[model samples]
Target: MTLEARLAALAAAGQTITYGKLARDLGLRMEELTNALERLMEEDAAAGRPFRAAVLRQRLSPEGLPAPGFFLKAAILGRPAQDPLAFTRAERHALLPFPNIPG
Candidate 1:
């Protein structure tokens, strides 16, 4: 399957993946994978669509402590959208820090 198809399939299967794992699976160097992902993001942005890949973050520790550093839990293609505000809200939320989270 093509790289994008493989990524979509993994997402459909509800499998969480990271850049390292994806690179290994696709037989690409880490830099190559990064470039590919960036290209996808750029294309989506240019098309005025939601990012093709979603980045999920999670605490490193079970106690939800921030000391261990956050990690990328998943990267998946976004679903078709009928509402543009949904994407705007998500982007706004991500860029603007909330009161609870430290900047």
Candidate 2:
């Protein structure tokens, strides 16, 4: 399946997939999958999609150290990652429909 299709599928499934999982799903390398994500994000913006690029951070436990499953706690459409807590729920909602995001 195409990268767009892959991301759309995950969103439809309401899954919080990791990079390795995404790579496995597409039968691509980690770097390639990461690139696809970037491309999808660009396409999302170019298509005038309101959803911006962001990472999904679902806490594994109620407490303890951060998990290593995801790349970062939070990130936006631009560079320089930021913590998810800094973003409001509404802002995160704005990024919900973008590539590789679950509904």
lDDT of 1: 0.46
Assess candidate 2 and give its lDDT.
0.46
TM-score attained by model 2: 0.52
- Which lDDT tens digits does candidate 1 get at residues 1-103? 5567765564445343565666778898967766676676667656764443443212243332211111121122343334433542353344332423654
Q: How far is candidate 1 from the true structure (C-alpha RMSD, Å)?
A: 11.8
Model 1: residues >4 Å from true position, as ranges? 55-103
Candidate 2 on 1-103: residue-level lDDT in tens? 8766655554444444545555677799967766666666566556755322233333453322223322231234442235433332333345445535553
